[model samples]
Target: MSPRSPREISVLVPPDLAPLYPDDPSRIGPYLVLGRLGQGATGTVYAAVDTASDSPGDRLVVVKVLTSPELDSADAYPALEQRLRALSNTDPTRVVVPLTFDSDANPPWVSMPYLAGERLSHYVTRRGGLGTGKLIALATGLAEGLSALHTRGVAHGSLRPSEVLLESHGPHIMECAVAASAERMRGAGATWLSPERFRGGTATPAADVFAWGAVVAFAGTGRVPFGPGEPEEIAERAAEGSFDLDGLPKGLLPVVGRALDPDPERRPSLREVIGAVIAVWQAENAGEDGATGSPGRDELAHVLEREWQAVEPPARVPQVIRLEGRMSNHRPGRALFLAGSVVVALTLVGGGVWGLARAFGPEEDGALAAADTAGERSSSESPSPEDDPLTMVVRFDPAEQESPATGPWLYTPVEPEGELVRGQGVPTHAEWAERWEAAGEPGLAVIDPEAEVLCAKFCAAPQHLFIDEEGRGTWELTGGDFVDYLSWGPVVIVEVTFAEEAREGDDTPREIVRVTELFTD
Candidate 1:
């Protein structure tokens, strides 16, 4: 027989027909168990209806019953249950938060709002790869969910296609840290595991970043970057950086590439990834007009909503179960298992991973010193005024000393003879405005000819070197090609020029400028 295609094996099994063991509960807490939804090595999930609700049939929820021996500890269930309750109440749109849970039950169970949608894996298999627009929308939602988890010091250790549910509103992230713990205890691994995880490193925010990259790759190409294989083999490939990106969209390559980098320290933060992806989307659609031209948060959300509504609704409403029961006596043989689970969970949530700490160091002191040294070296190696016609050496004014309030140091323009102009501090926008008025707002000049110019043409603009009081700027130079040079030195030389048209804001009309180039050591 020929090998089965993804479409052939991708037939989704209905929840009603999912196998239900005789021991499965008929009822959990305030919910009536309806049918088995799915089962993993560590847990069994079920479709259920809220019996306590006056309108019981209006909506359904899911109940996950953990079977791992590691969760038998007296404290484990309570801690996990409390955390689930907090998450469910915090965000409903981005994540599938638990409505309630009963850690005290014989098999601790969590109830979450039943998502009436297919798993991301199923979607990819059935529909093939998604377009760039939809992928951007999905990535944005997942990034937001991860950001929320990270903000609370929680890491979605297992972020993969199976854990992402595509709903009408947006993509919902399910089974976060707790599921990761369960998988670890069961000795079941995923291809999306970061290289650090394969090396026995603890899970962290960076791990999520790696997994997020993998998820994005899978969604865009309809295949995992490392390809399908035994878990160990896939992990080894990932560690060796053997993934392929042939089918991934060009615009998404940068964000996904940095995310899947073997070194976790090199991966962009979740927030950074979000911004980068959004910028890519905006750039791709730059020719469009009005709201459609630029992809903002609202635009991404709208895309998600539209994609979600296009899919066929599930046959049955999803369910949630509020588990209710008392904690069973601890088993002597389960002590070690429970302890191991606790340690892993704590390591992921508390940011206690040994490799991460060592990679970044306990503090940034060494990194800062290294950056300063590199900056100095770059200055020394720069071309002399005689060799480079455009080269201009500048210094800070001796009389106007730089204070903490003055921000970063500024250099003065030097002549071909190596002559120094009067030193002056890099001024703030307010100070620049004052200087502009003092100089009678003279036309932009290359050389001051007289005293050293305090704030030169580009430097004097609000959007160039200084930000407004609201901490907003027309351009952001944090990531992508702009910040790549920052790794070599502490300072970057950027050339800013005024735009053809000015932007009228609520407070005042401001001169907008474009950042033409960024040069680093």
Candidate 2:
């Protein structure tokens, strides 16, 4: 059977798009730009509709159009456009639809099915990360898609999470176009790039295989393979292949571990990668392993539907924007997409004003809009960190109350243990200290709701980094291990003893409650 474009495919999902900025173009080529979809280093991706099409399948298509370089200079435009044309010419891979390009248009663009759902990056950031089933499903879909593309001699030079869209159906691998020459695409971020790319190798099928490992590793665990840092820092570590596939399950370890092999020759082909993924579930499920494997398209689709229920999209952009009289030639100012190597910024045309209805609500301050789209997402969806400060870290004192190794421990936010447990006569850290002094019986730190409690280590700006979960989160620090005592039941801390520690990039120590675990002092 032939592959169908996303627009030609059927499912239920209305376009979740933000309204165009005053500087954004009303129409690109023949399609009316209904709203902006997302921004990345390549350019602004818009959710647009073709008024001429009466069929629902043909009504909406996503447009990837270039804008001025507030985010990028004009010099790189040709190369980016090359990637666009590269994407447009490819035959549809499994579940990945074909693209349609309009080269004649200024700042040329390509159109594809309007995929509904959050970018993998956004979804991971918002909902922690994918579960085992969905992770397998995602990995399977991507491997299947890439394997098909490789058969056609195409290598998706860039395979970062941003390049993969998590739709209702499954993972859709975008921009699988290879450059006319064998040279690798320059902008694929260093974090996800294979070691060979850093060594000056082109974006070969092998490179894609390596990068695919990085993408899936990131999908299953929100942290990138290598710990977080600046591009230079990450590039240095990535080239050395020093990332931890830590949080991933044992069965799926080889899928990422082997594929991430620095030597391209040693890396498995996409086909082999798919087999490994299947082998994982097949081994566990035993007799039930079917032709399509355990978690296939249907499973992935169901996972998305369940997970996406609470994930309210940023308001919807109209499927059709009236252009009869309101159409204008005002090209959108410049758009920036800094995704991966480059974080994406939206198109912004300054000094122009429009009183149009915005799908994303009121206009953000120009300065704020320049930040990553995650800001837009947070504003539209969840409360800011300022509103809910739940970032924390684990510290193991390993010392008893009597000896109570004298240290900066007292300074940390000890659960004000005026009472025990939750209102169970937990005493304040100070009170506990006083009591420990009296009876030598140490107490837990109870949160003094009256005073502000600060995070000790693993604390940083944009509290989003320290997710409210276990497994020492990606705090951008290069040191420290989580205090692991699994017997603590499902809870990591029923709370803690008070102690002081340093947060990221700060010499000033802050207060944090510590868990009572036996550490060999």
Candidate 3:
């Protein structure tokens, strides 16, 4: 539903602002109206609780009464409710799935889990633009939601900041099935309407893409992409290509720009949009090990915490422990001596050679071994490659490579603890050489100085890799040249073959040749 005009008093607020109104219904089928959540052109949503449930502190739900003349018909309610139920059963990752619906009531209404959060418009208004990671998370969720609907031949005709609810987990698309048909030509901001919709075309999936871009622009800039004006004025401005995307993150600009393309046919599909967003997110959060995965619920929580702190500074907890009685006033002059003694004791007990081996061995090797063991145990229980939910594949173009021509490039993770690494446009030849020399040039891989260097802005795309039991690596890129690489960020992957030095416990005497592949996906 469209957001209420800025001049009107907002009924959406914390519990304090959601008091019951005289005209509001006390009961909606099995649900008891707790208070008014918000009112829109189509209907008024109320905070509700299931009256039949005996449990105390029952989870709240929201019931939207279909008061609009166009949507209140008996025949329309059944079809709409059925569509919503089907959409809800399709997936729960992208949208706020509907709980139930009542078509037999005096006024048909639909129930959905009550998300304790504000609309995207209010969030941007209160907190300004979201950080890159949080924005990516939101974009990913919304795109997935749209993808789910589009796959089922349903379109979210109205997709705007007002239709998005920002919650602790991630942003959730609201009023999916019902709103698509009910509010196809009304109850949406002008800036979010696609050119096709304005020209009397039906709301297609592409139109939803256009609206998605506009909403994203609004989130990033706290202003509509087509500038501010009346609905008609804004539509005209959009037709004239007057929208500005200056404030969007560099990594997201390309995707958003393409989505906002004046020609609806030029806009990328919802799945493609999601891939671009993921690519940017992976680059930003990639760890030193070069393994990449989608951000988990924990990351979303972190974003929520930051937003919360921005609106209301967290109260500082008082320090309960005092150092006065726990330690002597005078600093210990023999601190160095004590530390030295401990080191000497360790060396003596472990042996000088063994101690040196511990210090010199690759620190990550042990962790990798542990991870391998755990992965082996879980692999059997995990879905097969075909069924794997996380597997993502995109075409790789060798001609788009961006690194310099040099000998011996090293591959490393973006963050020490990160699983995804950029493998496409990172560590130019010069950078690789510096790292190689510093690491004592242990690998057999040679970089050829005379090799041609291919560089392009769209060289690096986010990828996911799978390592087989034999330690062979395979990977898939997530975006392409048509996708904006600048907004997606840069990454590189390199493979090195080297002789691993034998340690004291090894049965083999010395060097054993091994192939090591480094990737950012």
Candidate 4:
């Protein structure tokens, strides 16, 4: 890690977007990773900016991960999703919730707003101990935040000092790093986990309350209540109640002590914790003109501003990046098989379609396909073909022939200009204007091979109007060719130009595809 302050570390050390160590993923979902925010027992968090966000400040998000429904038992996925989404319904004022997530992704990830502040530990270490007023404020805000989570049926499974951010207003809690399928003992480090958790208990709202006490205690004094060591030693000390509650405010002692009770049941509920913290705040500020129950309105806000100014995270995103593409484990590959519209380095057929691969072709389970990692799903934005197609493969039918077919059937996603398809040799805007005088050229949709099934009722090839054998698409004798009727004599490869109607249409242009072109059978 860089020697910069925790907040300053968000600024990218590299000038342009550098590859975050070679081991880091180039892309997660759609978001490109500019730099890694931090890593913990759960997973790595990448700092990425959402350029699409209307407000610049609201764009920074830390993509860690969401619940992995695929890995969960069938009965467990729904419940896990409910819990993760509950993070959103949380009180935004006191909780930084998950902003985006892809449940179908492997090792599913959820992105959360990287709120503006330093870790709680960073603030306590920088300013030494939080004074009585600030401690009461911090305690109240944390308790209320946790209470809100409980209301949504979401327990922040892991609530350590690192999980709390001391912003300008007060402490806001972080999401539980793990997207759990079933409850399990979580994050037992830095002496914040409840004793029940140490002895192997699942995360419960009570466990969260216990962790809250530990975080508050740490803020009051820079020392960990159970002196630092491995998790085992901390658990041992917690059970013995040999706490180092040295500099804690006397008024905060009772409530904090109740919250940290060794037994989960004995620990105060978050509501009780909130009321207790408020009572302490009242006692500490006796004889003041403050209202009875409002602990955080002005008093806490004032304490935060005076004591805990938000340490700006200098997170710089070069352009910005997006990150995911999973619908589910059952069909994680389904999206890949469909028209990704991604350009790949595949050998083109007759210099026509750029990439025609089984990966982008069929939608069957366990069929892995190759695709570029950095970008996904482009509508009009799919990259232009590497080179303008000089030769096209198609099945052609004349305007005089009776065949119902739709599009100019270019193999690449880009539809060629009407003039080029008509063999006019790259006409200019004015040239097109003169040619289009007879008819308006409606834009042709680039037919996606992935989207188009191989077996179709009709197809059209551009007719080059060659006097030689090539111009006659005739299974002909003239053009005996409707693509469906030409199963007899060998299917041939031929190139051609657009008909007058294909070039100028008030509505949609005609579609012409060659299952195989006929040089002339």
Candidate 5:
């Protein structure tokens, strides 16, 4: 937090391209240059407008140009481009909304959601230390966002304060700005980065947490966590250093310290870190006017209970239908696992008496099991509850009918209202469920808790990706199972589920339910 002047550096485009950009602004595709926002060692960013989408009502976007062809030509560019493009469309809760990527575009550009807010660095610079409430909100939101990216097999290589943007809702990390790559690490200032990263190691959740600790320190006292100096010096110190948080606020010190741990493996998981920070905030700030900390655990729990009770849960609805029993000799087994692409085929095959048409009901006790038993002609009923029928009825239209249906739906009723929660490297069923709850309560299709829980609405779109919630890669689903996937900065993967009921409120919702189960390999 050095009291340096807020410098707005302008980038002068090459002369030959002057006609494309009337005012010396770089031109790429259908975007109009406004002014230079900032610049890094390998790239320059501009606050530009999408001429294609700028017809009165269209929104603005910030375009980042990787000026150094050397890095772009290296192996890093392709992977970075693919990752960024994936994040933008798939992740709804992503702070950094990638609009498009054109490596062939004159400057090799990447367009993202033009966030109109102060950088986390600038925000702290202008307004000293953030209050506890705001800090808690910011940290919680960020941790969740990072968790989402990690779940998608991506790690934000860079997590500095400046890389984070503070928006009206919360913090939005800018993944492209850093333009992290293996070449960038090996070529130029690799020595200035963290020790674990410099040793040919990629980014991880633990490292992000460590950077987050530095961000907390910066927010508390305008200074880099590893002690401010030249960029290289700071990076070098961080690679082999630790932070001393003894003087910081009692509740926040632990978060700052744990995140700043030198060893990536030793640091707290994002879930653990968030839990600690949230607990501290709740304990100290609950009900106290202008207080940064929350109330005690019991009090906060009571408050949460009261709040939950106040908002009546949405009535259950039928979205998708499934069968539980094994399909006999005639067609597919009684319990059929249809490939996402084979919906119509399965419907055609399961018609007539063999088809068990079970209606969807709410999340009541025996409703699911009862629905599974609608059409079978078995007497002894050999299997118990665990081994009983497995048909799940998901009701998409809960509002259409009030009285409980005789059968159950395939999807579960998830509460999807709140800020988005990021997944860890791989998310568990619970983490996926939590993210669903945060994303305006979107519906979820737990395909195989033993395999991949078909999580919908991790961001704005419905994404379907397999995570080794069980830790063994044996259950991973490759490529096609998901409808769409979006990356938010470098911290989250927005799993796109195409079912009609997977709609979300305005902003992209992050669904961070199970972090321990995230798989990267």
Candidate 6:
């Protein structure tokens, strides 16, 4: 099946979308637009300044301004806004945090806590699998985040890797859809299956699981879950339960197989898949006897390391190359997937998935794997350190703490309070610090609500090379390509930690791989 043209999937208006806002940019109620972050199919996100308190400018927020005024006021989308608001109130951690909901504006907008990080696409392309430990951390945290949404009777509907944000805080899911019922829903909310959704079908948790599998596929191989084609074609193949899994790691075969099941009912739940993946992760890291026999874990780890280094940062001198790409080229409501390939190409290079397409694309599916490598090589370059901040490293510390009521806590230096013991890495302490420092002193910070206590749940920390006060450019690594579900931006990282007493109980440590570096110049 041929890929659909851009005009087939969605339409894009001119960049001058801000004029629709009738109110002053600084005082939308109590929220202020510090800078324009990015726009999505449904809304525009701006880095907003919360002027509700004394330290008005100090409080940062992501204000999601709806692009269409009619959609906001119409009764057709009744439960849409209400559903998101409910999600925020019931499960604060389920989706991103929504601070305020206001329909007073021409196009209603919501103010949410600003996420500091890059898009997951950017991070994954720049950095390959973050080792077994990091992968476990990310997957587990995201699972909990998913669980939070599910518990609230909300299905992410869209659970693609690009939609998942890997923030300094942790991995987070975004783009909740109650409004999608108006059109159609199908096959787990993955964009590649949009056409199939229009046929009165609804996206279920199982579909979400399948898309999660695709996310894992991209994370592991840096390729699409299925062969590259239009949304209809991909859906057709997915419905047939046919996928190219030759490039997937043998350890992940079982999980991928179950996730891609043609029958949604046959697919595992997100919780179950998370358990299975976590088990695989544990086994993979079990050392000598415990490591899976499929491939040399050390060799794979090294390959991933090289891939991470290949994502050259943009040039030190910032020069905006205006690409005359058309968002409107893809048809609105149609499956324009050539763009998916392009998205894959761009994100893989950006995430540092070196030779990923080459490793997994063609030899596995008879597609042009070389094409992806060539594309990545041609366009990949280190982002400019000047004008924009270069995100060096992102670390999630479940142990980090912050004062309460201060709102979103900021990044602080990691103390490394003997967090690691023997049998973890480098086999000793001396090597651990060396490795940590070499990795660029990555630490964790939180945005918890504690009156006087130090709560560590909502922490965001990034290794910043150059901090930009202008706030014009977003260092976006993950979640940059998708819309914000809970808050103004997508949830890049979602984390849940348990105390020692509860560790033996149902509560255990959870880590969501956060897409880091959204805020830069």
Q: Top lDDT: which candidate number?
A: 1
TM-score of candidate 5 versus the correct structure, residues matched by position: 0.47
Ranking by TM-score: 1, 2, 4, 3, 6, 5
* Per-model TM values vs. the true structure: 0.55, 0.54, 0.52, 0.53, 0.47, 0.49
The digit string of per-residue lDDT tens for model 3 on 1-521 reads 88634322212212221334334555565555554444444566665555444442343567776555456455676667666667767676567766776554555667776555545754575467777666776777788888888776678777877677665566677766455442344323567888777766667899999989998888887666987555678778777767888878899999998998879889999889977887776677677234356656556445433533333211211111111122221212211100010000000111011100111011100100001121133223322325642221112222232321221222232222322335444444234323321222222122222221121211211111244343223221111111222111233223222234335564432221221223321
Q: Which candidate should be chosen as best, given TM-score against the real structure?
A: 1
CA lDDT, candidate 2, residue 381 = 30
TM-score of 1: 0.55
lDDT of each: 0.51, 0.47, 0.49, 0.48, 0.43, 0.41
Q: Per-residue lDDT tens digits of candidate 6, residues 440-493?
A: 433333222111111111111111121123211122222211111111121222
lDDT of 2 by residue, 268-352 (tens): 9887888788677566555543534456655644543454354333333222232334434455323321111111122333321
RMSD of each: 26.1, 16.2, 26.8, 26.6, 27.2, 23.5
**What's model 2's TM-score?**
0.54
Which is the winner by TM-score between candidate 1 and candidate 6?
A: 1
User: Model 5 segments beyond 4 Å from truth?
Assistant: 1-27, 51-57, 68-70, 90-94, 177-193, 198-200, 229-241, 287-521
- When summed lDDT is taken over every stretch of 10 residues in candidate 2, the lowest stretch is 357-366
Writing each residue's lDDT as its tens digit, candidate 5 over 1-521 gives: 55523222122221111011112343334454543444334455554444344242243455666665345455655676666665664453635756777654445667776544445544564456766666666677677777777776567766666566664455666653233644465432332245676665666666667667767776766544665344556566766665444445679887667667667777889889879987876686556654455556555434333322221212211111122233222212112211111111011111111000010000000010111112232212222213422221122322222111211112333333465444445453335444443323333332211222222222111122323332211222212111111101112323223222324463332222111112221
Give candidate 3's error at residue 503 in angstroms.
85
Give per-residue CA lDDT, model 4, range 113-156, as digits (tens). 65555566545644677888778778878888888887887777
